[model samples]
Target: MKKPRLFNLFLAVNGLLLGLLIMLPILALLLASSPVEIMKLLVDPEVLTATWITLLSSFCALPLMFLLGLPSAYGLARCRGRLRRSLEVLLELPMVMPPVVAGLALLLAFGRRGLFGELFSNLGIRVTFTLGAVVLGIVFIVTPFFVRRCTVLFDGVDKKLEEAALILGATPWQAFLYVVLPVVKRGLFAELIMAVAQSVGLFGAIVMFAGNLPGRTQTLSLAIYSSFESDPQQAFALGTLLLLISLLLLAAVHMLAPRDRRL
Candidate 1:
C-alpha cells in the first residue's frame, strides 16, 4: 500500500511540474493582449493578407507532401537493404537539421545562383522570394514529419491483408487505396494536422529562403516578427492567434491518433 502511494505521489508531482512549465508561458501569451489590440490587428490589411498567405502556402505544400511523401514512406516501410538505411537517414536529415541550416540549403539549391540556377534561368523561371518559394520552404520543413509518421503507420499495417487483396485480383493501387489506407487513415490525419501546425509556425526557413516580402511571401510567423518592434500590441495579438491555432491543432491530432497503433 505504501509503495503504491509513493509511486502515485511521484507521478503526480512529476506531471504537475512539467505541466506548469509548459502551460505557464503559453497561458501568459494568450492573456497578455487586450481585446482592442486583437480586433485592430484582425482588421489590419497587412495582417489579414499575411494570415491568408500563411494558410495558402501551408495548404499548397500539403498536396505535394502527400504525393511525394506517401511513396517514400511506403517504400521505406517495406525496404531492408543498406540503400534503404541510407535513404532513411537522408529523409531524417531535415528534421534534425537546424531551421536556418535547412533554409540555407534550400537557398543554395534553388536560388538564382544555385545548383540548378543556369537551367532555371534559361527557362525564365524564378523561384526565390516567390509564393512557390514559400510553399517550398513549408514543404521542406514539414515533409519529414509526414513521411516518418506515415512510414511507421504503414509498417504497422497487416501485410497479409494487402497480399490477400492482391491475390483476389485487386491491383496494387486499389489494394493500397482500399485496404491499407482505410486502416491507417486516422494516423495519417493526425500526422497531417501536426504537419500543418509545423508549417504554420515556420519562421526561420521561410524568412531565409522566401525573403519575407509582404503580400508576396510574408507569413503570419514572419508578420509577428516584423510587428514586434514597431507594434508590440499587434505582435501580441498575432501571438495569441498563433497560440490558439497551435493548441487547437494539437488537440485535433491527439483526438485523431489511432487508438491501436498496431492497426
Candidate 2:
C-alpha cells in the first residue's frame, strides 16, 4: 500500500476515535431514559421549576450581553497596541479561571461583606443566593464567548462598506445599524445561541456563586447534579434535553460559519 494512503487512513481512524470519546458518554446517558420516563420527569414540579429558572436566567443574560458585550467587542476589535492587549487579556481571564475562583471573585466583589458589597447592602440590594446572582454568574462566564465571537465577526467585515455608507451621508449609528450589523448578524446569532447553550449546562460557577436553592438559583445543571444520585431517571431526562439542545446549537454554528471556517 502507498504511504500517503496509509497516513490518510491513520488520520481518519484517529479523528473518529476522538469524536466518539467526546460523544459516547452523552449518547449512553440519553439512551438510558425512555420517552415515558422523560415525560414523567417533565411533569414533575421540581424539574419544571428548575428548567424555567435556567431559561429565565439565561434569557436575562442574553440581552445584557448584546448591550454591553457588543460595544466592548467592537472597541477591542478596532483598537491596537498595549491598551488593547491589556484589555483582551483581562477579558479572557474568566475563560481560563476556575469557576470556583470566578465565583469567589464575584462573592468578594458583591457579597455582603466584600468590596462594593456594603454599597449594595446599604441600598437593600441583595445579589447573592438569588436569581440575579445566577444571571450574573452566567454572564461573567459566558459573556466572553459572545464578545470573542463578535470581535471576530466585526473584524472580518469589510471596513469599506461602512466607509461607503458614511460617504453616502449616513450617520455613524445608521451605518452600523444598517450596514455592519446586517453583515455579521448570522455570526452574532450563532454566538448568542451558543452562549445560551453554555449557560444551560453551567454548573461549577453558578453553584459557587448562586448556591443552589430550588426554584430560585437552582439551574438545570445544578438540579441534575442534585437528582442524579437519588433519582437517576430525572437526571437522565434533563441531561438528554440539554444534550439535544447542545447538539442543535453546534449544528447551527457549523451551518452559520463561513465555509473557510467550518470544521
lDDT of each: 0.90, 0.87
Runs with alpha carbons beyond 4 Å of true place in candidate 2: 1-4, 252-263
By summed lDDT, the worst window of 10 consecutive residues in model 1 runs over 1-10
Candidate 1: give the clashing pairs.
none
lDDT of 2 by residue, 46-162 (tens): 888998998899999999878989988988888889998898898889999999899989999988888988999999999999999999998999998789878889999898999
In model 1, which runs have C-alpha deviations exceeding 4 angstroms? 1-10, 261-263
Q: What is candidate 2's TM-score against the reference?
A: 0.93
Model 1 clashing-pair count: 0
On lDDT, the leading prediction is 1
**Going through the candidates in order, what is the number of backbone clashes in each?**
0, 0
lDDT string, candidate 1, 1-263, tens digits: 54668889999999999999999988888788977877787788998999899889998999999998988899899898898788889988998989988888999999999998778888999999999999999899889888988999999999999999999999999999999999899999998888898899999888999997999999999999998989887788999987777889999999999786566
TM-score of each: 0.93, 0.93
